[model samples]
Target: MPPKAKSKKKGGNVKSSTVMDGLSTEDMSKDQLEEHIIHLREELDREQEEKSYFQLERDKIQAFWEISKRNLDKTKAELRNRSRERDEAEERHRVEIEVFWTVTGIHATLNFNEIPSTGTGPMAPQHDGTATKWYCG
Candidate 1:
C-alpha cells in the first residue's frame, strides 16, 4: 500500500473530505470507509429526491403553458370572426344608403309632386275669390 498524503487544514479547522483523492480502500480503516460510503449514499439520495421534485414542477408549468396558449388562440380566432362580421354589416349599410339615394333621385326627376286634383273634393277660396288648386298625387 502507498503512504497516505498529508491534507492541508486552514486555520486549524478540520474540514471533512468527501472525495478520496488516489486513496485506496485499504488505506482507510474499516469504520472510516463505512462512514464515507454512508455519507455518499445519503448525498446521492438527496440529489435524486431534489431532481424528482424539480421534474414534477416543470411538468406542471408545461401543462399550464399549453392550456394558456390554447385559450389565447381561441380568443384570437373569436376576435377575427367578430371583426369580419362587423365589416360585412358596414358594407351592407353602405349599399343600403346608396340604394336609398338612387331611389330618391329617381323620384325627384319624375316630378310627382305637381299632380292636378279633381274638383270633386272641397276647395279653399283664394284672395281673388277663386277656388285654390290642390296637388294630391
Candidate 2:
C-alpha cells in the first residue's frame, strides 16, 4: 500500500487542501480564493437583479392581461344588452303594426249611416206627415 500525501493549510482556519468539484483549493493562493469569492458574489448579485426585473415585467403583463379581459367582458355585456333592446323594440313595432291593421280591417267591415239629420231633431215629422216619437220601456 502507498502512503497518501498530507494536505497543507496556509493560514487561519481555511484548509488549502479542500476539494470542490474536481478542483483542489491547495493550488489556489489566498488572494486568488478571495478574488474568486468576490467574483462569484458579483455574479450572484447580477443574476438576482435580473430575476427581480423579470418578475416585475411578468407582474405588469399579468395586470395588463387582467384589465384587457375585464374590458372585453364589459364590451360583450354591452353588446348583448344592445342586442336585447333592439329585439324588444322590433317586437313592439311589429305588434303595433298588427294592431293597427286589425283595427282598420274592423272599421272597413262596419256600416255607417250617410244621410244628414233634419233640423227638427228626433221629434221631427216623417215624410208620411206623422210626428216621429220614441218610447224607452
Pick the lDDT winner.
1
Give the per-residue lDDT of model 1 (tens digit) for 16-111: 644475666667888879987998899999999999999999999999999999999999999999999998987786677569768876331233
* Distance from true location, Cα of 90 in model 2, Å: 1.1
Q: Judged by lDDT against the true structure, how good is candidate 1?
A: 0.68
CA lDDT of every candidate: 0.68, 0.68
Clashes of each: 0, 0
- Residues 50-84 of candidate 2 have per-residue lDDT tens digits of 99999999999999999999999999999999999
